[model samples]
Target: MACYTKVEKETCIACGTCGAIAPEVFEYDDSGFSQSVLDNNKGVQAVPEEVAEDVEEAYEGCPSGSIKLNDTPFKPKTPVSS
Candidate 1:
């Protein structure tokens, strides 16, 4: 079971609600908008199992409708070996 999340950054109001609910999964960018902790995902990131509930709460609490929560399978990129 995976909880894939994405934030529509263009419309993000930087409310910080998601961050406040799940700091480990969401963070604020330089512009102060809510973004996924994992980068280079075009706003798509997998919420840790431990914080899945928090993400869900954030999604519900988001007033800008920027938070998108999904249960579909998420395949993160494999880091290249140095």
Candidate 2:
């Protein structure tokens, strides 16, 4: 299953825990807040298969509990035929 990572901007405290834990996936924004450095500047980033563990570690170590792993892909559902 594919997974993605995200940080709640409102809840983030800019502690840099996520960046420290996973610099490849996380970085401090211009405002000093932590954000995902993936998807061409979009805060949401896909978790690489190799770095899944690192992302998980960052999520666990985040002090503000803002980091998250979204395993479900977002897509509009089609109506079911009876």
Candidate 3:
């Protein structure tokens, strides 16, 4: 089975960016928190790279910076000096 997880409600500010960016991968639950719907059969039904990027963008663009994208591998990028 693939690893599947949802965003942390405590960390999610309900910006709806996840649903806007990748509805197929995320949706609002009963509490209106973003939840992951990627089901793992043999492996996790991976979100497309573009969708993944969008999710990351949502995370970064969150006004409260409270969005959390779980089950996705994230590597910190090296800072680029202007």
Candidate 4:
């Protein structure tokens, strides 16, 4: 199954806990805030199966509880025919 991860920029404290635990998937931004290195650093991105464990560690290690994870792939709802 695919997994999605995101960081709450506003709530982030720049503590580096996530980065330290999951450097492969997380890193510090130019502003010194923790951010996911996936999706071109767009804040939210898919977690590779190999790094899913690290991503989970980052999520749990975040002191501010700013890390968010979605275990399922996003599927937009289809509009009903008129």
Candidate 5:
């Protein structure tokens, strides 16, 4: 099973919690906002199933609720809720 995560840059506070919690999956972009290490920008990435827990932790730790996770490999591209 493949897990995936995405950070909503528009809502992200650029606090770096996700990066700190899951460095393997999340990192700060040049703009100072959290982005998937794989995407390297405003996009999502498929995470290894073994790190799902850590990814969930990062999502839960996000104060701005910018981290989104999906159990399915292909998640719907939904708009960032204002």
Candidate 6:
């Protein structure tokens, strides 16, 4: 139920877009390497509501686009009876 699903650390390139987009959910290590602070069985760090818009923006802005999100499944609506 989340769009942001996987994060390719090797391809991340450490641009810091993720951290900038979601600081509360990301942080830079002392080694100057940016790392995600959140992770789960569903995915790594579901985007926060307050910064959802920003995260999407960053996702697009990512040079490598290493950040991946889950796509919601579509549901068909039932037809009304006449």
Please give each candidate's TM-score.
0.76, 0.77, 0.54, 0.77, 0.76, 0.59
Per-residue lDDT for 1-82 in model 2, tens only?
Answer: 6788777778899888888888888897888778778752343456778878888999988888988677863343378999
Deviation (Å) of 49 in candidate 1? 0.9
Among all windows of 10 consecutive residues in model 3, the one with the lowest summed lDDT is 38-47
**Model 2: what TM-score?**
0.77
Span of ten consecutive residues with least summed lDDT in model 5: 37-46
Clashes of each: 0, 0, 0, 0, 0, 5
Give the CA lDDT, 0 to 100, for residue 21 in model 2.
81
Whole-model Cα lDDT of every candidate shown, in order: 0.77, 0.76, 0.60, 0.77, 0.77, 0.59
Per-residue lDDT of model 4, residues 1-82, tens digit only? 7788777788999988888888888877888777777864544457878988988888988889988788754343378999
Q: Model 6 clash pairs?
A: 3-69, 3-70, 4-69, 5-68, 5-69
Q: Candidate 5: which stretches are off by over 4 Å?
A: 41-45, 74-82
| Candidate 4: regions farther than 4 A off | 41-44, 73-82
lDDT of 1 by residue, 1-82 (tens): 7778878788898877888888887888777777787643353556678888888899999998988877774455489999
For candidate 2, which ten residues in a row score worst on lDDT? 38-47
lDDT of 1 at 81: 100
Off by over 4 Å in 6: 29-33, 40-45, 72-82
Residue-wise C-alpha lDDT for candidate 3, range 1-82, written one tens digit per residue = 1223346667777878777876767777788777666642112355566566766666666676655454744343378999
- By summed lDDT, which 10 consecutive residues of candidate 1 come out lowest? 38-47
User: Per-residue lDDT for 16 in model 4?
Assistant: 82
List runs of model 1 lying over 4 Å from the truth. Answer: 40-45, 73-82
lDDT of 6 by residue, 14-74 (tens): 7888778767655665655455555521254455577667656766777887765556422
Estimate, for each residue in 27-79, the C-alpha lDDT of model 5 and write its tens digit.
87778888887655433467877777888899888999998777654445688
TM-score of 5: 0.76
